[model samples]
Target: MDAALADCRACPRLVAWREQVAREKRAAYRDETYWGRPVTGLGPADARLLVVGLAPAAHGGNRTGRMFTGDRSGDVLFAAMYAVGLTNQPTATHRGDGLRLLDTRVTAPVHCAPPDNKPTPDERDRCRHWLVTELGLLAPTVRAIVVLGGWGWQALLPALTSAGWQVPRPRPKFGHGVRYEIAPDGPGRSSLHLFGCYHVSQQNTFTGRLTPAMLEDVFAQAKSAAER
Candidate 1:
């Protein structure tokens, strides 16, 4: 599934921007090769918890080829996950750095890195297909989801509804530590518990908008919901 996602070039703007960043290269990582393509979600197949992020950082996942890797945002996220016993390690420096997630899958609304860390509405809508497919495949085992940031929270709802989950007519708003339970419309499907968390971006972390304990608390809630 991920292999095909990595090959997508559906958005011309994203395609060009990612490649341009790769070529221009950051001064500190001039010798490193950038993946410069769509990034695939990562985690175990039987994951009970799914984490949704906004998009890849220009020099983070775009360079390392793994979601949330090689950046301060990743450092904060993985460390919190580790503290909550969802990861084997507390840091995500690179793809092959021996990091592992337990019963958790991490994905994003957009795959490619966007300029100024923001993807236009059209781009987000175009990228929704990938997430829809991914959510459908994980529907069986995924009992809970942790959406990081407003973008991912908003992006996931329509996809989940398309994937067969029954969402409310008036969608719930996004807020840190907010949770909404969606019961399955059809038989043979488990109920989904959605938890919201502030993005682990540098802007939030450095400003202390999202602290380690706060993130861990959300993960703990997600874990508990997954187990139930």
Candidate 2:
């Protein structure tokens, strides 16, 4: 996975798009490496409670390399994770920023920056293979998964469903703190607990759609469910 991300050239369009953004937004991340390349997964490779986010923002993950860093969404998400004891760091401003996870790990469906914050269906399809591979490696030890938005939920459904688990009728519709069980495909394997929440994007916060308290409550629930 690390090698794939480090040398990612999967989406030429995204590669060109990111380089353009870097050139135009040069001053913004002048002092930083502009992680404009691909942002592989971050956090412990074996930690439980994996967080599935949508994708990296041009200036956020694209600039910082660390998921959910250097942007408004990251500011909101990390604060809540800190409050719930999920992360050791309270802020995520840049890579090598001393940020660390406690019981949670984070990843995205698309590892590379997409054009205009949106990836085509084909792009997403190509990216899901990494997600599937990561899921299998992380699933055995993970207790719960916190999927940030509806797209993330949809991307992962097929994998869980094929494993003989009844994924959610009407499919676990997205809403903060909504939890469901991914019944095991095997006789004795543990079930995968799933939770949903907003993506913590700037629009959601600035528009008054999701407040700090609301986000915090969802994190609390995720932690408790993770422990259970």
Candidate 3:
């Protein structure tokens, strides 16, 4: 799936943008080769906890080829995860940075990095199948999911439903620290605990809207929920 995801060029706009950024190259990363493809989810398949974000950052995951790596958002996120014992390291600079998630996997709704960090509705819809497939694969052991920001939260709920969980009428709204228990609609399926957290974006962190403590609290709750 990872290989197939990497080779995907289903969205022409995303394909053009990602490759353009990769070719132009951020001045700081000029010497390095960018992955320039859809970044795949990280961590083991049997992970109990899942972290969902909007998409890859242009110079962050797009350059480093891993979700939440080589960016300020990743710095804030990985630090909080490490503090809560969800990862082995607090820093994720590159793919070979020796960082390891502890029974936790991090992924995104859109695999490719979009212009201005925002993917169009059409692009998001085109990429939805990948997330649905990933969720289906993780269904057995993934008991909890922490969706960062409302974009991810909105994108994830429908995917969750397609993956076998039943979403309630009117849908659940996204907010910091919101939690919802979604029952599996199929036989032999496990119930899932959904959590919401502010995205660890520089916009949020820079303004103190999402502090280390606040993020840590969310992860701690998610870790506990996953254990149950």
What is the TM-score (0 to 1) of candidate 1?
0.98
Tens digit of per-residue lDDT, candidate 2, span 105-223: 88888887777778887878777777877777776677788888888877778766654456767777777778888876654346778888877887789998888888888878878
Worst 10 residues of 2 by lDDT: 159-168
Looking at model 1, the pairs that clash are: none
Global lDDT scores for all candidate models: 0.93, 0.79, 0.94
- 1-228 in candidate 3: lDDT tens per residue? 888999999999999999999999999999999989999999999899999999999999999999999999999999999999999988999988899999999999999999999999899888999999998889889999999999999899889888889999889999999999999987656998899999999999999999999999999999999999
Candidates in order, TM-scores: namely 0.98, 0.92, 0.99
Q: Among these predicted structures, which one has the highest TM-score? A: 3
Q: Which has the better lDDT: candidate 1, or candidate 3?
A: 3
Q: What lDDT tens digits, residue by residue, belong to model 1 across residues 1-228?
A: 888898999999999999999999899999999989999998998899999999999999999999999999999999999998999999898878899999999999899999999999999999999998898888889999999999899999998887888989899899999999997776556899999999999899999999999999999999999989
Error of 2 at 156 (Å): 2.2
In model 2, pairs of residues that clash are none
TM-score quality measure for candidate 3? 0.99
Which whole-number lDDT from 0 to 100 does residue 79 have in model 1?
Answer: 92
Separate clash counts for every candidate: 0, 0, 0
Looking at candidate 1, the ten consecutive residues that score lowest on lDDT are 182-191
**Candidate that would win on lDDT:** 3
